[model samples]
Target: MSSMSAPSLNFLAGGGEMGEIIRATDWSGSPLGTPETWPGSLRTLVQVMLMSGQPMFIAWGPERIMLYNDGYAPMCANRHPWALGKPFAEVWADIIDAVGPIMDAAYAGIPTYMDDIEFLMTRHGKQVETHFSFGYTPVHDHEDRVAGMFCTALEITSEVAEAKARKADAERLREMFEQAPSAIAVLRGRDYVFEVANSAYQRLVAKSDFLGRPAADVIPDLLEQGFSDLLDRVYETGEPFIGAGVPITVTDTETGTTIDYMMDFVYQPMRDADGEIDAIFVEVADATERHKAEKMQAILNEELAHRIKNQMAVVQAIVSQTLRNAADVRSARQLINGRLVALSSAHDLLVRGKGERASVRKLIETAMEPYGRGDGRQINLTGTEIEVGPKAALSLALILHELATNAVKYGALSVPEGHLDIAWGTSVDEESTTFDLTWTESGGPSVDEPSAPGFGTRLLRGGITGVESRVELDYSPGGFTFVLSTPLADIVIS
Candidate 1:
C-alpha cells in the first residue's frame, strides 16, 4: 500500500482516516486502472461517502467493486481492508440471499428503503443475528445509465428484540387472567369503563355488554347496592378493599327473577410506572352454595333433636304399660325387653339418616323375631312394598309385638299345628290411596271373644292410628282374624 501523493487526488484529502487509506492504496493490478482514469461519478461518490459520519458503502461498475468509509469499518469486523477491493456480493456472501434483490433493484435505476431488515451472518466464527434500517439509492454513470448503488445503514437489533419481548409478556398476562377459576375483571379510568372481563366474570354477571361501557351503566345492580361508591373510593385513594362473605342480590335481566349471592371479593388498585392509579382489578369467589348447605344442616339438626324428645316419651309409655300388665317381676322384665327390642328395630331404620322412614316388611320381620317366629313354616307374610314415617312405624312395631306375644301364649302360635298368615295390599278410592293389612290365625283350638278387653286387645284396636284408620276383630270357631285399614299418605315419608 504505497502513497499515491498525486495532485489530482485532492478530493480524497478531506475524508479523515478513510481518505488517507484510499490515497495510500495501489491500483496497478486492479480491474479499474488508476484513480486518474476511473469514472468521475464513482470518485466523487466515494469522496462524499468517506466524509460522512454515517455508515456508508458503494458498489460500483459491473463487478460491484466494494468501497466503504471508516464509519462502516467496525461493521465488517475482521474483513475491513481485505473487503475493500473485493466485490460487495463476495464480501457478504452469507447474507447475499437477503440483499441480492435490493442490490439488483438499485442497479436498475430503482431505490429501496426498509426500516428494519434482519440477517443471520457468520461473524468472527460465531453466528450472530443482526437487524438494520437502510436505504439503497441508484448512482448513475456519465451516460445517465444506472451502474452502481450507494447505501446508508445502522443496526437496530436490540430495539426489535425488546419490542418482541413486550408482546410475548402481554400475551402471557392475558392467558393467565382468562384461565383463572375466580371471576376477574378490570375497570379503567375515572368513569370506570370495563377494560377486561374473563369467562368467570361473564357467568357471575350473566351479561356480556360490559366492554367499553362504564360500570354504573352496564351493572346497575352493583350501583344500586353502593358497590359503585366503594369502587370510586378505592380508585381515588389508590387503596385496596377486601370483603368476605358479603351478600349481594341481583335481578336476572333475562328471567326477571331475583337471585342472591354470597361472595368473598377484592378490589385492588393498579398503578402505572409513575405510581399513579389507572385501573382497578376485581376478583370474586362465590360462597352461596356453602351458605345454603350450612342452612340445611341447621334444619336437619333441629329435626333430629325433636325426634329424640318424642322417642323418650314413647319409651316411658312402654315402660309403664309393661309393669302394669305383667303377672310377676320376671315376666315384666321379659315383656319390657321384647317391646324395647321391637321399638329399637323400627328406630334403627328411621334414624339411618337417609330420611325418617322404615320399610314395612322389615319392621314386621323384626317384631316376630323375639317370639322365635319367622315366615318360613308356621308364619307367612305377603305384602306390596310400603314405607312408613317415624310416627306410623313406631305404632305398627308396638302393635305387632303385642299380637305376636298373644299368639305365642294362647293363640295359633301356642300349638304346633297352628299357622299364622299376614297379608297387606293397597286400595285407591276417590278421596285417596289406602292400604289394608290382615292377620289371621288358623288350625288351632276354637277361639271366641274375651270377656273383657286387656292392654293387648286395646293396643291392637288403637295402633293403626291415623284418624281415617279402621280396625276389625273376628273370633270364629276356626281362627282369630284382625284387619286394619288406613290412608296411604299417613305412612309414606318420602
Candidate 2:
C-alpha cells in the first residue's frame, strides 16, 4: 500500500502564547482570564483562537487535558462541571474506543487524519452511530519534542444511516427479480443471449441444470420461429414487443403426440447506467386451452348458423303454403297444423346446435338439395372464409331457399341445363361492412319481374331484418340476380 500525504497543521494560537496559557493555567485551565494578563496584541490573538470553529484543547500537566473554549466543552455539555479537572479518560471513558487511537497518534508526534469514520458512542443511555472527520496533531515543546496532541472532528451521523437504508432496498429488489413467478429471461445483443434467467425460465426450457447458456443455443426452435428478430428489435430500439395467439409445438413423452400451445409474450428492453439498452426481459404465458376453446366455438357457430336458416325456411314454406291451399277456414286450420309439424322438425335441428352460428356452405347446400342435385358445383360458391352469426345464417338460409324455390318453379333450377352462380366478397363501404353477394342464373327459361311482390319476397326481406343488411331481387328476361349487402362485422370469423 502507498503512504498517505501529511496534512497541514497551523495552530489557531502560536507556540509562545499557547505555551504561556498552558503554564499560567492549572490542569483544567480555560481562556476565561488568561487573556487579561497577556499583551493587548496577545490578548486579541487568544480571543480569536478561542472563537475559532474547531475544537481546541491544551495539556498543562500529566493526565490533565483542558478544553479552552465553547468549541470543545459543548461536545460534553451534559457532563458535570466537577468532572472537567479530572483526567480525560475518567470523563470520556464512554467513548474511549474512539478517542484512544487519536490520542496515541498525536502524543507520539505522528499526525493522523481520518474522514467519515463511524463508531457507536453512548449518549443519554442510547448508543448512536456517530460519523466524524478527524485529525490529531501533537503540540511541540521549545526543543520541538512532542508534548500533547489536539483533536479536531465533525459529526456526520445521518448521511451514513441513509446510505445504509438505500443499499438494503436495492438488495431486496434483486432478490425479488431472481425469484419471479413468470418465465423471465434477460437477454443482450443481436443474438439475445441470456444474461439472467429466473427460476421459472429454467423450468420452461426443461434445462434448469444449465442456466448460463446463450438463449439462442438453448432455445434454437425459438430463433428458427422468428422470435429472435423480435427480441433483437426490442434490444436495439428500446421498444417493447407484444404478441398473442402464437403457437408452440410441444411433444409429450407419455402420450407420444404433438401438443399445440397458444402463447402470448412480451419483450421489454432494460437500459444500463449510460442510458443505452443492454438487456431485454422476456415474459411468456401459455394459452393452449384458451385457443382450443376458441376454435371449438367457431365450429359451433357455423353449425348454429346452418340450423337456424333451415328452421326459418320451414316456417316460411308452412305459412305461405297454408295460406295458398286452404279451401275453407276449418281446412286451412288443418293444413296449418300439418305444415307446422314440418317446421317443428327444423326447429329441433336449431335447438341441437345451441345459439352459435353455422357453416353457410352447408346451409346453402342443404336448402338447395330439395330443388336439384346436392353437388355444390351446380351452384358456384367463391369466397374466402365467410363466417356468419346465428341470425345472419338463419336469414341467409331463408333467402337462399326462396331463390331456390323460385328457380325450381320458374327460374334456373327448373331446367336440367340451368346453373346458379353464387359468388361473395367483403369490403368496407361507408364505414360499414358490406358483403356483396352476386347470384346469377344461366341456361334457364326466360323470366320477368313478378306482377306483384309475393310471399317469397316478403319472407326474404323480413328474414334479414334483425341484422343490418339489404336484399335486392331483380328479374330479367334471361334469368334472375339477387345482390345482398350486409355489415362485415356481423359476419366476423371466430
Candidate 3:
C-alpha cells in the first residue's frame, strides 16, 4: 500500500511540543488521512490557532478529532499529550453532557457564547471545579460548508470563587444588621445621607424609606434636638460623641401624636479609604422606660420613709402609755415588749398584703401562733373570709394579743388541758353591716371578775374605735368569755 507524504505545513513548522507531536503523529490510521491530504480550510485554521497566544482548539470532521495549541495544554491538566489525536468526546468525557449541545449548535453554523460556564472536571486524578468564559464558532471547509467546530476559552475559576465568597460575606453582614437589637444607621457622604438602616432604626423613626435621603430631611425633629448638629461635628472633626438620657420628641405616624422619649446614643465618624471623615454612624438605645421606673422608685422610697417615721412615733406613744399604766418597771417592760411583738406581727401581715388590706382570719392566726401549737389543741380559730383595712387589722391584732395574754396568765392557755375557741362572723341588715367576734375559754382554773380592771382588760375594751363598737366580758365559773361587735363600714372591704 502506498501512503501520501506529510505536508510542509506552517503550523507543524513551529518549535513546540504540540507542533512536534502533530508532525510526528502517524496519519495512515486516522480517518482524516495525512496532513497533506487535509483540506485547505482545516490546514489554514490549524496554522492560525498555533501562532495565536490565546487558548484555542479545533474539533474537526464527524469524529470531532482534538487539535489544540500550547496555550490550551494547561486547561487539559493531566489529560494533555494523551488528549491529542483523540476524539473531543473522549478528551472531555467528564463534561461532554454540558459541551455537547454547544458543539452541536456550532456545527450547525450557529455560534454560541457563554460567560462563566462551570464544569466538574476530573483532572490530576481528582474531580476539580472549574469555570470558563468561552465561544464556540463554526469552521467552514473550502466548499463553504460547516466542517468542524472551533472553541476559544479563558479560565475564570478564581474570579467566580472570589465572587461567591464576597456574596456570602455580604449576606451574613446583612443578616447581622437586620437582626440587631439596638437602633443602628449608617450614613454616607458629607451630607449625612442614610445608606443602611436596621429594623430597629426603622421602628425608632416610624419610617422605612430613608435610604439615600439626608438624615436631617428624614427626621427634621432631630434638628431641634441637636442630633443633626452632633452628626455634623462628628463628620468635621472625625470624633465620636456619646450622650446619655437625651430627650427627643417623635411623632407617631399612625396616630399623628407626638411622644417624648429618652435615648442613650452615640454619633461616630465613619472614615473613607483616604482616612477622611465622610459620614456618621448612629447608634441609639431607648431609655424612656428605664427613666420612668427610676422616678417611680424614688417616689416610693420617699413615701416609705415618711410612713416609717409615723410608725415610730406611734410605737413611742404605746411605750409611754404602757409604762405609765404599769405598777412596776418589770411589768411595764413585759407589757411593752409583748405589745411591740403584737404590732410587728400585724405589720408583717400588712406587708404580705402589700400594706393594703389584710384577711381577718390571717390576723388572728398570726397573732396567736406564738402562744399555741397550730394543731388546734390549745387554741382554735374559726371564721369566714373577711378583709380589713390596715388600721382595723392592727387594732384587732393588739386586742387578740391582750386576750391571749390574759388566757395564758389565768385563762384557757394557763393549763395543759385548757383550750380556747376564737370565732368571728359577719351580719348584714338593711341599716348596716356588722362584724361579730367571740373569744371563749374552757378547761382552765376558776375565773373571777377583777374589782379594778387591769391594762389588758382596759386595752381590749377601748383599743377598738368605731361608730357602733361594743365589748362584753363574762367571768363564768367554767371559763372566761369575751364578745366584740363593730360596724364593718370602719374597715375597707376587699
Candidate 4:
C-alpha cells in the first residue's frame, strides 16, 4: 500500500487560480484518493475541463468528487476556494433537490441538456432566482465504465426576466385598450388593416369583425364619407388630424338602418424608430347627444325671448282693462294688483311644469291659496289630471281670481258658513275628448243676475276664447254656480 510516488500534475497546470487550488489541496483521505492514482479517464476529463474558456465542471467516481474550471469560479460565489475538493452534491447542497435527478440521469449515461432550468438558490446569504442553460455528458473510465458526469453551464436569469417583463407589459397594455371608455382603434400599413379595435370602436362602427380586416372592406361608408381621405392625409404627411363634432353615419348590418353620429376624434400617426409613420391611432368620443342638447338650448333661448314679449303684452292688456272697468282709483289699484298676482301664479305653475303648459291641479291650488284657510272647508276641488296651454292658463287663472273676489264681495265666500266646490272630469268620445269643470257655491246670501255686460261678465265669457272654451253662469236663490267646457286638445299643448 506504499503505492506509486507523487507525480507531476501537467493536466492541472497553468489553469489559473482554480487549478492551483485543486492541485494544492490534500485529497489523500478522501474517496478520490491522491490525483497521482486517478483513473486515466478522470484525469483526461479534468485536464479538458480546466482548459475551457466556458464554465465547465466534472464530478467523478461513485462519490461524485467536484472539479471545475476557472470560468466556473464566479458561479461558486463565496464557496469557490472551499468548494474545490468536495463532492458535487455537498458543494451544491442548496440546489441539490433540483439538480440531483439530472445528475443521476447523466451518470446512468442517458445524458441531459437544457436551454433553461430554474432554481431558487441561496448564494451570498440571499435566495435568488437562478436560470441555467446547461448540458450534462457522461464521462467514461477504463473498461468502458461510467466514471462521472461532465457539465457545461451558463446563467441566463436576466434574459428570462426581461422576456417575462415584456410579456406582462404587453398584457397590461392590451387590458387597458380593451377597457377604455372612448372608441380606440389601431390601423396598420397603407391598406389600413385593422389590428386592434376596442368594444367602443366596435359599437361606433356597428360591427365587430374588425381584427386583421381592411377598413374599407369592413366599412365602405366611412370611405365614402371621406374618413379614408383624412387617414391618407395623416399617414402621408406624418401629422396628426383632429375633428370636432364631425358628422358620421353608419349603417347597421342587421337592420340596414343608418345611424347618425357627431364625433370628436383624433387621427394620431404612430411613428417607428426610424421616424417614419407606420400606423395611425384613432380615438373618438361620440358627441351626438351633446350636440343635440346644445341645439335644443338655442331653440329654448329663442322661445324664451318670444314668450317674454308675449307675457308683457298680456300684462299690459290686463292693466288697461282693470283701470278702465274699476269704479274708483283705489278700486282700480286693488283690481290691478289682484289680477297681476293671479297672472304671476299662473306663470309660476307653468314654470314648475313644462313652461309651455300648466297642470290643472296646480293652477287651482295656487289660485285658491290666498282665500283657503287650509281647513278643507272653504275650497273643495276635485279634478282629473289635465294640462292647460300657457295662453289659456293665464286667462283661466284671472277668471278664477275674479270669481273668488266677487264671491268674497257678494256671494258664498262672504259668510262664515259659505264653501265652494269645483269638480272636473274627462268625457272621451269617438270624435274628441272634452274637459268639463263645474264650480258651485253655497251657504251665503242670494245672488241676482247682472243687469249689463260688465267687465267681469265680458272677461268670464271672452278670456278663454283662445282655447275655444265657453263659460256659463247661473244665478239661483240658493247660490251661484259656474261651469267651463273646452276641447282637451285645445288646452293641452302636446
Give me the candidate number with maximum lDDT: 4
The count of backbone overlaps in candidate 1 is 0
Please write out the lDDT profile of model 3 over residues 1-494, one tens digit for every residue: 12223345554567367877777888778877878778888888788888777888889999999898888888999988888878999999999998888898998999999998999999888998999998999999878999998888888889999999999999888788889888999889877789899999999988888799987688887776787778778887888999999999987666778888899998888788998888788889999999999998996686466446545654665566567668999998887787778667755765565367778888888766544344787788888998888777767876776676577667777667898999999889999888899999999999999999854566677746443578899999999999998888776542
C-alpha lDDT score of every prediction, in listed order: 0.80, 0.63, 0.80, 0.82
Ranking by TM-score: 4, 3, 1, 2
- List the lowest-lDDT window of 10 residues for candidate 2: 1-10
What is model 2's C-alpha RMSD? 16.5
- Compare candidates 1 and 4 on TM-score and give the better one: 4
Better of 2 and 4 by lDDT: 4
Q: For model 3, where is the 10-residue window of minimal lDDT? A: 1-10
- Residue range 1-494, candidate 1, lDDT tens digits: 42447756656766677677777778766766577777888888887888899989888888888888888887787787788878888999999998998999999999999999999987898889988889999999879998788999877788899888999898888888889888999999888899999888888887886799998787899778979888989998988999988999877788988878999899999999999999999999898987888897896676456446545645665566567667999998988798778767655654452447777888788766544447468899999889888778867776776676566555787677889998888989899888788899998878879899855677688856554678998998898898988888876752
Q: Who wins the TM-score comparison?
A: 4
Better of 2 and 4 by TM-score: 4
Candidate 1: stretches off by over 4 Å: 2-55, 69-84, 94-97, 119-130, 141-147, 250-258, 297-360, 363-383, 386-494
Where does candidate 2 stray beyond 4 Å?
1-10, 13-159, 175-181, 188-193, 209-213, 249-260, 299-494
Expressed as tens digits, the lDDT of each residue in 1-494 for candidate 2 is: 11112111122233343333433444325433333333333333334546566655543234634444445554554663444445667677887787776776677788888878776777667776777776776766556766555566556577777878889886786577668766777777666667777677666655554455677677776577788677767876788989898987654333545556688888888888999887788887776677889997996686457546644654565455556656888887776776566445444434444367676666665555443244565566666566677766666766776677677666776656788887777878667767777789987999888778655666665546466667787778778988888776765432
Give TM-scores for every candidate, taking all chains together and pairing residue i with residue i.
0.61, 0.43, 0.63, 0.67
Off by over 4 Å in 4: 1-20, 33-53, 69-82, 123-128, 142-145, 307-361, 364-425, 430-494
- Clashing residue pairs in all predictions, respectively, total 0, 10, 0, 0
Q: Which model, 1 or 3, shows the larger TM-score?
A: 3
